[model samples]
Target: MRLTRHTDYALRILLQAAVEPERRLSIAEVAEAQGIARNHAMKLVNELAGAGLLATVRGRGGGFALGRPAGEIGIGEVVRLTEPDLRPADCENCALSPGCGLTPMLSGAVRAFLAELDRFTLADAAKGTRVPLLIPT
Candidate 1:
């Protein structure tokens, strides 16, 4: 399944945090690194923080960090959280919606896709990667 840009950015943000676990990162840094808008990054960061995937701090010298270890964060979990809809096909609007075998097949495909992603964690994706993923401010 093709992921939405939102999910893609969210995953990038998580990977950035995973890569720099020791340092708190700002939305501007994430936006610059991911080539996304600052406001978009801020919204995604806030959503992630609300989900307990990221920890945010306020006031001067404030930033964000991974709420838990990278290894503890599942790639599938992130996708599920960020993806508003997982249905592969719009079978509901099809003329054959009443008895369409494709619907079940598509649903199974989505489940399989998620299951494969569930096998990997943020640490797994960030493994062997350096801080070069993020641009210096």
Candidate 2:
């Protein structure tokens, strides 16, 4: 399934943090590096911080960092936390929830997708990129 732009930006932010763990990063740096809007990155940073994906500091020299180690953070968990809805389709609107052959197969597919995501860590995401955009602290 395709992730929304919000989720995409959230991933980018976490990946950025993973790549540059030495110093805290500002939303502006992340936005500029990823060619995304600063406002968008700010919102994504807030969302990621809320989900325990990253920690935010206030006042001078304040910025964002991973809430936990990069290897400890699972992409599936991030997706679960950031993704607005996990459902592949509204099984509620679908008449298949109770008992439908199609429902089982579709649900299985979603589970498989999540399982794949679970195999990767934030470090994997960080290293997966060809050239990481490392921002200064």
- Pick the lDDT winner: 1
Candidate 1, superposed: residue stretches over 4 Å from native: 131-137
**Per-residue lDDT tens digits of candidate 2, residues 1-137?**
88988878788888888878888998877788888898888888888888788999987899999999999999999888878887677777766677767777778998999999999998988885643465555
Clashes of each: 0, 0
The TM-score between candidate 2 and the true structure equals 0.87
Query: Which pairs in model 2 have colliding backbones?
Result: none
- TM-score for each of the candidates: 0.94, 0.87
The alpha-carbon lDDT assigned to residue 132 of candidate 2 equals 49
Off by over 4 Å in 2: 95-98, 128-137
Candidate that would win on TM-score: 1
User: Residue 92 of candidate 1: its Cα lDDT?
Assistant: 82
